[model samples]
Target: MKVIKLDAIDSTNDFLKALASQDELDNFTVVTAENQTKGKGQMGSKWQSESGKNLIMSALVKDFLYNNEQVFNLSIVVSLAVIETLKSFDIPNLCIKWPNDIMSYNKKIGGILIENTLKSDGRIVSVVGLGLNVNQTNFTELPHASSLAVITGNTFDKDILPALIIEKIQEKIGLWETNSTDFWKQYFNTLFKKGIPMPFKNGAGQNFMGIIQGVSSIGKIQILLEDDSVSEFDIKEVQMLY
Candidate 1:
């Protein structure tokens, strides 16, 4: 539970990854920054946040996944952890967009990017980076983005939110080992737009209609197509056009 607070950094994930390479980091070791000069999102998207107004942090997780194939399970655990934390604050309509986008009222509020490294000894360690919109409200240029303050009309203490989220993560990390069936069930339940027909765009920018049935064990989204055939798609292959 060692927490390092920084005034600003290029990226908390990069900082934590560098720190782990030089020294031994305990499980759940955390690095948080007030501002990230080069914050990143899924697929190289930029994560923009006003200084001191959001929660930008990374946590080190070791000895979690038994093998590389179980990597998506870690994503499920972390995504559910953030969703549960926000639910505690009574954030209305909180749901996780497939593969780790935190949403509220169909608006984007946060996201997760996980980087896993396999050690020479075959151990996998992950740096889980999270960016949550907390108090920042100005998203005029980014129409789909909104903060907790904007949604609830009340500012939140960024300091407290990360602690709660980490605590929630710690509580659920063991579920992967104990009860994976129930673990996946919880994640699917919180999945945004599940079981609903929606429009999706492919990598080639072709639009099609499908329903999100669930995710594969390897993390691909399983979509029920218009022809009643279920198809699996990698994250890069499909984008929800809601």
Candidate 2:
């Protein structure tokens, strides 16, 4: 798990995609940038960063590591990995919002982006990119953002951030290697809501309030409503309101 550190780049994920196009690469190969000029997030949303104060990195994983069914679970696995890693740094009260946002004290501190590519050999490659706020203190203009330093009131050494995150990713990634109950349990425990009615807009542009029941094995968010009937949503099929 060696990180190919960069002074700056457009997008680490794009850089690694080019590497995948050029030649064979090893799994767990990380490409991190000091600053990203054109970073994209889920739904092709922009992933903005404050250059040196944040963690901007992406990992290229080979097909043998995961498949379609496993890919959805991987998001939960990776998100949990990040949440646990931040906790290890003494950043408590960390919670994972549905899909891939890390929230603390009701504010966002990090985000994860997962991309899938198919190879000519009938295998899938997952490129997982992560953007975590680590040491910045001036996000007042960026309202929805906060840094680890702000929450913990201590600065993080950027030099070792990527490696530590990658190590945690590998550990959580291994949970998929076996049918570990803790994987799902950890994800569920960190779930955004237990039984309270949460406002959400489905992918179809419909707004509804449904109590989040837990994520299904198929990765769809299972929402239990006031009617006692359950409605399941595929990934990206539902979005929670701020």
Candidate 3:
């Protein structure tokens, strides 16, 4: 539960990974940055956040029983944690867009980037990085981005948010050993646009309509297409077009 706060950093995920390389860190050790110069998103995209106005953090989980086969479980846990935290704020329309983006009112307010290092023995060390738009109100060039302040019309104290999110994450992780079946069920129930027709584009740049059937344990998305056939695609293999 060691928490390190930084005024500025290149990326919290990179910082925590460097710390893990240097010495052993306690499970749930967190690094938070007020300003990230090169924050990352899924597929190597840049994550933009106004300095001192959002939640930019990464947490380290060490020596887990999780193997490569169950990697998607981490995504479920972390995504549900963020969604639960936002629900506590009474935020409206909180839904997880497949793979790992948090959306509110059909716009993205947060995202996750998880990196895992596998040990020789089958255990995994995960570095879960997250960015939540907290108090920022202006997105400028990024039209699809929104923030807590923008969504709620009230400013939030950004300083306390990272800790709260970590606490929620810990609570979810604590339940993994005892109630995994029910836990993952709830995660699936929150999938954005589940069972509803939506526009999507495949890797070949072909557009089609489909419904989100639940995500696979390995993190691939299962889509029920217009013709009633089901197919699973990995991240970047499919894109949701809103």
- The number of clashing residue pairs in each candidate reads 0, 0, 0
List candidate 3 stretches off by more than 4 Å: none
> Which regions in candidate 2 have their CA more than 4 angstroms from the true location?
63-66
Lowest summed lDDT across 10 adjacent residues in model 1 is found at 171-180
Q: Residue-wise lDDT of candidate 3 within 158-202, one digit each (tens)?
A: 777777878887887788888888877888888888988999999
| lDDT of the candidates, in the order given | 0.93, 0.81, 0.89
* Model 3 lDDT at residue 131: 96
Ranking by TM-score: 1, 3, 2
Highest lDDT model number = 1
All-Cα superposition RMSD per candidate:
0.9, 1.8, 1.2
The pairs that clash in candidate 1 are none
**What lDDT is obtained when candidate 2 is compared to the true structure?**
0.81
lDDT (Cα, tens digit) per residue for candidate 2, span 19-96? 877878888899988899999877788888888888998988774444566667778768987887787888878888
**Model 1: how far is 150 from its true place, Å?**
0.6
Residue 76 Cα positional deviation in candidate 1, in Å, after optimal superposition: 0.8
Report the CA-based lDDT of candidate 3 relative to the real structure. 0.89
Rank all candidate structures by their lDDT, best first, as comma-separated numbers.
1, 3, 2
